[model samples]
Each structure stands twice: as structure tokens, then as C-alpha cells.
Target: MIFCIKLPGGLIKWCRVINFKESASGENPGNLKTPSCFLPSSKEPVRFNLYTDFIPLQKIVTNPNLSL
Candidate 1:
């Protein structure tokens, strides 16, 4: 899952949870602990719409693997 977290200096940044480790012997069995692998976004933030600015229309049409 992607999250927008505020840092100590009140800066907002994007990060993604790569792994979810479940807590053992806890009150809730299905409860999840902190993310084992948290990956920060490397790319710069976009100002416009992602679909229009980030991805090219030509690539989207030619690349069959690309999905909306």
C-alpha cells in the first residue's frame, strides 16, 4: 500500500509498504506490525495529472503489457 507520511520537519513524502509482518501471540491474530520493507519514492513528484504527464500516450497504445 502507498502512504503519504509527514516527516519531522512537516514535509510530506510518499512511500510504499513492500512487506507486512503479522504480530505473533498478540490480542489480534490478523493484526499487522510495522512494515518490514518500506520503500521511499525515488522519482520526483509530478505537478500535473499522472496519466497525462507521467505516461506517454504512444507507449500506452503500443505496449500491450501496460494496463490502466
Candidate 2:
């Protein structure tokens, strides 16, 4: 699954998710993970639950009025 984070000032970021079972069984750990620059600090972690299918990149790129 891909995750899109809406940051302050309306910036968008995307990342692909890796299930732990897949990673534990030796899937490409680095490839499936979010880039280090996208991660929050350990001292003030951000957390949330995903409840919907991922938003497609095309929709985001093509539409100017969509809001999460």
C-alpha cells in the first residue's frame, strides 16, 4: 500500500508500505521502507491508522481540488 502524508503548508509525500511478515521473511527491507527523510524523530513520533485504500498518484497529480 502507498501512503500519502499531507504536511504543513500543503506539501505531499508518498511511500510504499511493507507488511512485517514480508519484511521478516526477507523482502527488500530498504526498498519497502519510507525514506529516512520522511520519518519523524524518535523523540516525537507521528502515528495514525490507515482506514481507506491509498490515494492514487495520478489523481493527486491531475486534480487540483481534492482534499484529504
Candidate 3:
């Protein structure tokens, strides 16, 4: 699933599905298994707010036929 986050200035950022896995027995309830990156640019440094909370697959479905 892809997650689109809206920034303060109405800019939308997209996060692709890099990798995923089911939680282990002792793992945290809502943790992402993959590490995400910020887009590089010529401007000053960009800081992003990361959310580890797992959103349901139904919420971010831009295309239902596309594979994660």
C-alpha cells in the first residue's frame, strides 16, 4: 500500500512500499519493518515527521490492482 502524507503547505508526499512483514511474537504492535528516506534536493535540508503507526491497507489504496 502507498501512503500519501500532506504537508503544512499543501504539498503531498508519497511513500512507496519498499518492504513489509508480519510482526514477530514479541514485537511492537504497530511498527514498520522498512526504513524510509526523504527526497534529496538542491534546497536546504528537509525534515519529515515520521509515523510508525500502521495504517490499515484500506486507507491508502490509490490503486486497488497494483501490488505492494
TM-score of model 1 vs. true structure:
0.28
The C-alpha stretches of model 3 lying farther than 4 A from their native spots are 21-32, 35-52, 55-68
Better of 1 and 2 by TM-score: 2
Residue ranges of candidate 1 with Cα displaced over 4 Å:
19-68
User: What are the clash counts of all predictions, listed in order?
Assistant: 0, 0, 0
Ten residues in sequence with the least summed lDDT for candidate 2? 34-43
Top of the candidates by TM-score: 3
Q: Global lDDT of each model?
A: 0.46, 0.48, 0.44
What is candidate 1's lDDT per residue for 10-65, written digit by digit as tens? Answer: 67876644333233234444433433233344343322222243577788889969
Q: Per-residue lDDT tens digits of candidate 3, residues 1-68?
A: 45565656677866543332223332543544433333343134233323444444775696577554
Better candidate number, 1 or 3, judged by lDDT = 1
Greater TM-score among 1 and 3 belongs to 3
Candidate 3, poorest ten consecutive residues by summed lDDT: 41-50
Please write out the lDDT profile of model 2 over residues 1-68, one tens digit for every residue. Answer: 45566656667755444353454356756533532222342234333333233466678788968776
Which residue pairs show backbone clashes in model 2?
none
> What ranking of all candidate models by lDDT puts the best one first?
2, 1, 3
